[model samples]
Target chain A: MTNASAQAASPPWDDVSITVIRRDMLRFARMQLRDSGAAEDMVQEALMAAMTSAKSFAGRSAFKTWMFAILRNKIVDHIRASSREICGADLAGSSDMDAGLEEFDVLFNRRGLWNPDDRPATWADPEASFEQDAFWTVFDLCMNKLPEHIARVYTMRELLELDTAEICAELGITRSNCFVILHRARLGLRECLENRWFQGEAR
Target chain B: MKMMNCKDATQLMSERYERTLSLRELLSLKVHTAMCKGCSNYGQHLDVLRQASARLRAGNTSGEP
Candidate 1:
């Protein structure tokens, strides 16, 4: 029939497996928006756009690439709109977490050597950890537990893979300060994952 | 400068991703990591973390609803 012929011509957007890309899209959005609720909304919007433009898709590229293109644009718009409040930190006052840096001093002596009790322990079969869903759950929980500003910086630099210049420009921070922030962030995540996932398995 | 220790060596490990290390810094890290079990473990941890980030980039979904 005419209706059957028409349906066959158009790309099957409705039949597309969202399950194929949903988690990655959410992860992508979370790296940008830093809020799970906002990330979900953005992913939803991207999906809607993909569905509506399904006819225009020529199948030249992978469906996931096409969908991600839409999602990236949404993320850019969100960043531009939220740029004003990106830092969301009070410069006038220091936080108790600032004292957390002192903990590093205990790990390193005046000569910068690790104290006997402060050495990092060996982890068992770390690559295999990636295959376990529970490990990722612990990873996510640890990521969320990082101090707010540090977590944002960490996500930008590590997860998003933004260059130092871009991150410094986005956060309105100096080059050295950017490195310092990133260092602290890496240290924080390392310790958290070490304690919760790596060391937890040892027991 | 003071001899690179576990603390300084770990900091260098993180910095390795941002930019190429200088010859001196590179040699120091190699030497430090070679003998220190703790620093070696930390280096491996950094490598694992990088792999996890790479997985996120590749869009390999775990299909968690």
Candidate 2:
């Protein structure tokens, strides 16, 4: 049998387990970093880490979730290292306060909330006309408008699925400060999306 | 019953809406939302945003473009 055929003939999960998982990791990385290049790098590093530590996989959580946790850590580490120069400065000192005000607290406290079952009904279903492409376009635009640090933190915590404690540790932020940043990020995005897309809709 | 202010509602929205809040925060938000139209509406708005974001992510993953 051909190598490809042999692999295909195996169980589906066994045949493409790595690919499927890697894609998930990439998707998550993309969400967290919001930068394609950075997300790719983070995924590569995470996969390498996961493979090297395969023996440590105790099956405590689903493989995907465990892998995601590792990926999140890697992304956090990358963000911290790259932005080390600004670590000591006051977080609120920057002119990005407007952006910070909306996203800081909301994004910071967004852990343990990923399950579909947990989402509110109002958010459970989206409008039929809400194409993902258009939503992402607006989303990206709004994200791009954020100041770099605030955006980065929001991306890490919200998109990447890093827990607040992990983020605080990685970024050297206090819990209160993390919450503040997340709150600002969400508020800013809400306003941006409302004005840009949902203006006519009763808000 | 008093309406929850933007400050308090904003703080509780993500967690309460996501059902991730601690008992104290959850109860507080529940009590606040029970009487607060503004806060309840704000929570609904957050739900809209989350759904929108998820849809966007799903679309991206599916290669709809």
Candidate 3:
């Protein structure tokens, strides 16, 4: 809705060609799976499956959205299959990222007051950034940089919009533990965002 | 309620979203943040993160603008 972006358009999806779609799909899969080869294979698999179910293209969603849905399901299926094999390990040890605790520690001093250097600064016009693609790129990177277990809990609570009780049940964690994890997640994420994105602004 | 340190105050700030704080916890947090600009700004940053993630929940994977 910003005049600049409205006039310019974005993501350069104007091509909207299969090549473009495939590339975009691969990018998303790579981010989610964090494995280049695996992402490539999943996108290939999704493309093939989409061709077969082309008839199911009831025009309910955009082509990219439909394709993404297929790709996401494939990724989920892959995770489910793999996690089934490693189920015990995953349940027994979705450990808190110790580095996150260190990050939390640095935020305050021995006196339990904010460290002058690590103290939170007011972000400049943060809500205005929600509509910006470049901002999301920074956001995604900050998200991905989180330790896997932290990222997992954060994705469940924030992206999936799950309630804390539901998240605790799913993770087999106590309510208090879930609260701590969520708090640590917000702390780490906000710090990362500040360093990566807001730090660049002339404040 | 005992006074909350910045670390505990920030953690409580996060929990405030997931659950209602007891009156004591809420009052201590209120008293601390009322006097501490750093914790107050930290609370605002947490709100920004919440809003940003909500966009992802709305199905915008990339390129929100």
Candidate 1's residue-wise lDDT over A1-203, tens digit each? 38775565555554446765877789767765668999999999988988888866666556776777787777766665665576454321235325345554566777777667666788888767877777777777777777666776677776566788887777666766667666777766777888788886765
Q: How many pairs collide in each candidate, listed in order?
A: 0, 26, 0
Write one digit per residue (lDDT tens) for candidate 3, span B1-65. 45689999998999999888899898889899999998999989888887876555334545555
Estimate TM-scores for all models.
0.80, 0.58, 0.72
CAPRI band for model 2: acceptable
Q: How well is each residue in A119-172 modelled by candidate 2, as lDDT tens digits?
A: 222222346325444555666677777766777677766565567887667666
Candidate 2 vs candidate 3: which has greater TM-score?
3
State the TM-score for model 2: 0.58
Compared with the true structure, what per-residue lDDT tens digits does model 3 show for residues A105-163? Answer: 77778988888887888788976676667887887688788766667666667654568
Please tell me which predicted candidate would have the highest TM-score against the true structure: 1
What's the CA error at residue A59 for candidate 3, in Å?
A: 7.6
Model 2 misplaced regions, further than 4 Å: A1-6, A9-77, A80-130, A200-203, B1-3, B15-28, B48-65
Model 3 lDDT, residue A195, Cα:
83
CA lDDT for candidate 2: 0.60
